[model samples]
Target chain A: MAKDTMIEELLDAWEETYKKGQLTFWVFLALKESNKCMEEIKEFVERASDGTMTCEEQSLYRNLRKFQNLDIVAYDSRKVSKGPDRKYYYLTTTGEELFKRFVERNIMIFTKESIINLLTQ
Target chain B: MRVFTQRLGQFAISALIFTVAFRYALDLSVGMKSFPAALVCSIVYFGLMFFAGWYYGSKDAVENEIHDIGFRFHFITYVLCIALGYASYFIGWNTEPLRSLNIGAMSWGIGLALHFVFFLFAQKNAIRGYVKEEIFQ
Candidate 1:
């Protein structure tokens, strides 16, 4: 499919996951800044929430780290800084593909029944 | 309710222990001779706990309480102990020994040892009743 179409589908999937408590808004934001480094990530996080995150938000970030399809990295940005000044990131091909698929599927799976079932089970 | 209060009390005790260790290891007194930096550090430590308690106390009734109390105790005690060690080094920068190896060793050793003990205890107790209920029901 077209890249735009794929991106939309991934976004739709993300929205569904978010409603189902599988994904969080902060994860989406981090995914948006997949190309940025550690410092950039920090800046993005700070800016996104007006300089602070609650414990839940922090926990969500931790959960995002466990997603098998995502490949966040921390490497030295040769374009920006030299040795000893590395940057962190989270933009791998697998992450990109997963996100695309998520958006394209447009699965309407985040219903109250599904959520209750998940919580009870 | 009892568990919540007990955990809070434990956190308070740990904080007090850390504060005492910090003051002694760093020669910080509360009188007129006390350094402004020491006062600021103490305030910041308590302030952090206050905010942490308020925030976590209101989140998920069970999860937040456990996390908040656990995090405050561990984080404050560890940070204060390390800060005291580092501050001792900076203060004694021009002295004969140049640093208080004894203070650093004691602070780090006690802080880390106690942290591990408390961590294990908390983990063991985290889901005791809840897990049983969930499993049986």
Candidate 2:
């Protein structure tokens, strides 16, 4: 029991450190899939991350706003069936290019044969 | 623009509160009881200042995360406090306005200058990689 607890604590610390700024990546991936409202984006992120990541609506909103300011995201006001107009957000061309380069440089390396073999082993 | 307007509205409300409180406190403290009244006024003013700063800081944190409301709030506080302090003296409400204003203004001015420097440094760091127009565009 004590060994299990120790391992769990170490994993938690490792995950915390590893996951920093990863929300940005997941959020971009969601937007890259399609133009989505905030709710849709939130759902997509949670589902796509295989339940490994969860984010508060408030933090998501803040990230979206920052992305908008950075010209990494843009939104269209769509008239929803209920209530006020909802903003459907999507990546701008700049954002798409940025994400592409980021993935190519940072994410795609893990898919290398050597890395995959090492991981599987 | 909308965010700026929202912040301006919040600032205006705080300024109005300060003006009213300062005037009322000064009026309450007449000749013989002036010292105690001034003391009460100072307490009230500082308290309101603290409340306004915290209240609006939190509101801005929630609503205006992109903008640096810290520097803006402190800058406004310095300006308003100095203006009010001197205005009271000119209007014959405060007799020793210079003495009253000196300590607070000097300390806060130094703090505000530091805040401004920090703001500039943060701005530089934010734009280090990207062109300003590109980011905005």
Candidate 3:
């Protein structure tokens, strides 16, 4: 039981370190899939990351603004029936290319059979 | 609403500080003919400006939708400082042209030029948005 607790603690620490850098990747991935409103983007990130990652709406808005400034993302304001206009965001061409290069260089390697087998073992 | 008022109050305070310090520094160096004392005043002016910028600029970056706050703040502040420098000279607050310009305007103009270059490169990356019609058509 102590060994299990020890392992759990170690995994928790590892995730804490790893998760900090992963939000940007997850945010980009969510936008890449489809143009989504703020709430939708948050849902996508939480659902896709299997609840391991969560983000506040304020943080997401800040990130979106930064990405917009960098030309990595853009949005269109669509009118909603109930209230004010809602901004639906999507990855820009630059962002898509950036994500492609990032995945090819970093994430694709983990998909190799050798790496996959080693991870499973 | 609360945040907006807080930001407005901060802006008001910053403006007041700049106006008072800028005038005092100009008067000290130009009117008093105390170059060394003016230099100290100028340093204080710069320190206050830089602290206000770096502190609030970083916060503004994440909190506000505006991304070019740093560049804009530096540009506007320096421009106003230089204009005030020239105005002081024209108004006979300073009898010396070179000393007046050298004390504040010229130095800040150079800094503004460098900042402009940074803004150019940073703004260059800002491309056109994703237009649905363009893609569909």
Among the numbered candidates, top DockQ falls to 2
> What lDDT score belongs to each candidate, Candidate 1 first?
0.50, 0.76, 0.71
Candidate 3 lDDT by residue in tens digits, A35-99: 99999999999999999899999878877876785678899999999999999999999989988
Q: What are the clashing pairs of model 3?
A: none
Better of 2 and 3 by lDDT: 2
The CA lDDT at B94 in model 3 is 42
Docking class of 2: incorrect
Candidate 3 lDDT over B10-75, as tens digits, reads: 644685577566766667676677888877877787788777766766665446534342566666
Per-prediction interface RMSD in Å: 12.1, 7.8, 13.2
TM per model? 0.27, 0.77, 0.65
Off by over 4 Å in 3: B1-55, B64-75, B92-98, B107-137
Order of quality (TM-score): 2, 3, 1
User: Candidate 1 on A44-111: residue-level lDDT in tens?
Assistant: 66677665432244554344433321243223344545566544455466556655676556443554
